[model samples]
Target: MSLQFDIDAVLDRLATDGWVVIPHAMPAALTAELRDACLQVWQQGLFHEAATGRGDGQARRAEIRSDSVLWLDKVATLPAVAAYNAAMDDIMQAVNRGLYLGLAELESHFAVYPEGAFYKKHLDRFRDDDARTLTTVFYLNEAWPQDAGGEIRLYLDADCTQHIDVTPEAGTLVLFLSDRFWHEVLPATQQRLSVTGWYRRRGGSVPW
Candidate 1:
């Protein structure tokens, strides 16, 4: 995947609007491989119902979000997943250099939202945990139509009025400041697939 994006411009967007979107960030072939990997995981029953919160508070609640996820290892058995992890590591270095963010690691997972699945608006990072500094989501749904109804809506302010919606299109990448934005996944008329991840300030050689 030799796709390139304006890294400086994207970082500037993160500084200003707290979020940025890059269409076709991943190469078509690579995106196809990733999509296939996700579907394979689903078929193999490798995903678990997504849970909210952390530690003891973590629990699955269908009412909040009905998605299945398989957390990705930085060094995955799948070649495509390994390539993406390496790419993200490079981007992470660039981000840290530009912002002086002491990001130590990243954790990612493939998420699937079936029909009638929605996630109520919420912030990725809790007020008490500032460790989660950045969030990234890459869509793997090819040819997602406008009326397919699954769009991640990003609220611009505390009141949740001003917002922007993004489609679940293959190769599209979304980056945002995790603590600043409030976002939600709308019900999908069809299944929606994506790899969502977080960059953390946590230490050690592994992602927390």
Candidate 2:
């Protein structure tokens, strides 16, 4: 699998804007493979309704987030997943070199948002824990139309008065400071697929 994006460019934007969106970040072939792998596992009923919070605090809250997720840690042996992991590692190292964020590792999962599903506005970092430093999302839906309505609304201010909407298009990658942004997934007309993950510092909560 080939990673074709400019690391320096991405880092520059992350440093200045606290977020960056890249289209066609991965090769089409690799993106297709990853999408297929995600769908295959999902079809086998491997995905579970995503929950809110962590550990004992975690619970299914459909009103908060209505997506299904399958953590990548459980399927690391899959070729597409393994490739994606390697690519992430490369980017992580680049981030450390450029930003000195001290990101130790990444934890990720395939998130599938079915029709009429949505995630309410929220920050990625937990209220009591701040280990998650960076958030990343890679979209896998090809031919996604503008009217599909599965866009991610990223708030530009704490008050959430200003925001930008991002369409979930194939081979796109989005990165941002986990604790800095308030974002949400809008309800869609069809299935929306993505691999959502976070990079954490040492001694942070495990991704599982």
Highest-scoring model, TM-score: 2
lDDT of 2 at 80: 94
Task: List the candidates' TM-scores in order.
Answer: 0.94, 0.97
TM-score of 2: 0.97
* Candidate 2 lDDT over residue span 82-123, tens digit each: 999999998999999999999998999999999999999999
lDDT per model, in order?
0.87, 0.94
Candidate 1 TM-score, C-alpha based: 0.94
- Model 2, position 204, has a per-residue lDDT of 61
RMSD of each: 2.3, 1.5
**For candidate 1, lDDT tens digit of each residue in 115-150?**
888898899985556788899999999999999988
Global lDDT for candidate 1? 0.87
Error of 1 at 18 (Å): 1.4
